[model samples]
Target: MRFNTAPAPHLAPTASTRRIMQWVLVAMAPGIAAQLWQFGPGVLINLALAIATALLTESAMLRLRAQPSRAGLSDWSAVLTAALLAVSLPPIAPWWISVFGALFAIVIGKQLYGGLGYNPFNPAMVGYAVLLISFPKPMTAWLPPTDLAATPLGLLDAWSAIAHRAGPAGSSFDALAMATPLDTLKTQLGLGRTMDEVQSGPLFGALAGKGWQWVNLGYLAGGLWLLRRGLIAWQIPAGFLAALGGLSLGFYLLEPQTYPTPLFHLFAGATMLGAFFIATDPVTASTTPKGRLIYGALIGGLVFVIRSWGGYPDGVAFAVLLLNLAAPTIDHYTRPRVYGHPG
Candidate 1:
């Protein structure tokens, strides 16, 4: 018998890092568009400044680490990180604020931990948390939706607001700022207001905030698309939303006057964003099939607990970061048994 010789074995990954990052960026377009439609031109300004800062910082870090800058930059992890952090921020924040956050995200949150997959926590959330802690005032200085604002800011006005060197009509930054719906709700609840009284303002619409609910819907559309494309597993998102919704529903049913509607909790603030995008981060989330569910549920539960009782108005970033710290432990215990391993 004649033996046929074959070439040496080769390795090829089905989806490269660049491709994966591209998908993620594409998935964000709808959410970003929804935000722009509702908020105004400020989001665009924030995104531009943030992407620029992220790329610059990523390049610098790669150089310092003696890594190939081109390869690192091409993967677009920096871009995604910057975008997530940007969206989480108040759109009217100064350009320098975004620059600082992007720099911190790329450097301390990523490179300092050996970059990308090696980082135990989410880089974007780290930057966001740091900014929230350091610059509490500006971080919470959100603007009302364009339709709600008495004077909807034009592109130039947005530019002036973000630059902080000039004002559209000699008005201070605070003049254009308004509290977010979540912030308003928390303040009202603290003042001993009923849920009905708290959500009576124009800021509160059908479900969540006036313009914010649509943004969450847009993100949901994108997330469903990502799921259909098999880019992300459904277990995590399902577990997260289910846990949050279940818990919120229980409370709302018990004391509707004290608690906001369950829909409000589901569609408000960053709940959808965290469930679909942030908490689902593969590098920082649990890997095992069972572990993913537990991991996601833990994040959801923490979000509820913190939002109801903690200092922050929204808890998605904090919840995700906290769970990222426990992901390894979750995966270890929940790992699937080997095909031939004994029970």
Candidate 2:
């Protein structure tokens, strides 16, 4: 008997890359709006600068590589990368900072390795990590949340601060600047302060820091929207949050004086953003279902370790990059057995 030999199990149609990226961008809107509401026009200004720079850089790189820029530009990957990097940056960061980061993200992080799907690391996180390491002071100089500021910063003030690195009249940079919740916690812990005493300050809010909880909630909401729309896989965020919460809870329970609560870790800094947006990058994240779980758990564990013990206050960028490097290996070992085949 003659048997027809052909590829088995044809997959059904799925969303196009452009559509997926569009959904991702839509999901980011709430988080961006929250940042704008909480911080001021700096968020918008930074995003504008980053997006402009990213598009320019992407165009230049595509031209140099002799690839058509139309599809690349239309994909919205570069725009999303710029947006993520902008959000990671300090609200009042100089224009040059945004320009440099966006250019690097597109040209070096994405295009250098043949663009998009070929890049092994999360391009936005790579840009963020480089800026953090190279320009430590500027990168770490976050503005005081609006509610916590003695004088709430206006759009004009944010513009001036970014333009010339100066706050409004009668206000020094020191007056406008405040350490992030993670940074404050690390500093206070280094100074032998207990968790309770550290959190008693006005910096601490109902859960995380002032304004930050709302920001985190906004991201969480957006992330849930993405999940509901099937834009992202569920395993990664689930594993990430579970592992992080478990580790943090254990530490807090063991020594409440020394460790902050799991909820604080969950709602503070960039935890939600990193878990939902950064670590779920389809190009760089583990592809297999089981691999994704392992990848996310690794990132989560590393984040807790670095936040608690390492030099950096928040380790989202570092953790994501590290796990990105391991994604291929994770995928290799976690591949599911073919149907009707032996494991």
Best by lDDT: 2
219: Cα error in model 1, Å:
0.7
Number of the top-ranking candidate, with TM-score as the measure: 1
Scored by Cα lDDT, where does model 2 land? 0.91
lDDT of 1 by residue, 1-343 (tens): 9988767655556888889889988998898998988888889898998899999999989999999999999999999999999998888898888999999988999999999899999999999999999999889988888669888778999888898745568877777888888888888999999998888888999989988898898899889988998899998999889988988999989999887877998888998789888999989999999999999999898988887888988899999999999999999999898999974
**Clashes by residue pair, model 1:** none
Instruction: Count clashing residue pairs in model 2.
Output: 0
lDDT of 1 at 211: 83
Worst 10-residue lDDT window, candidate 2: 5-14
How much lDDT does each candidate structure score? Answer: 0.89, 0.91
Instruction: Give the worst 10-residue stretch by lDDT in candidate 1.
Output: 5-14
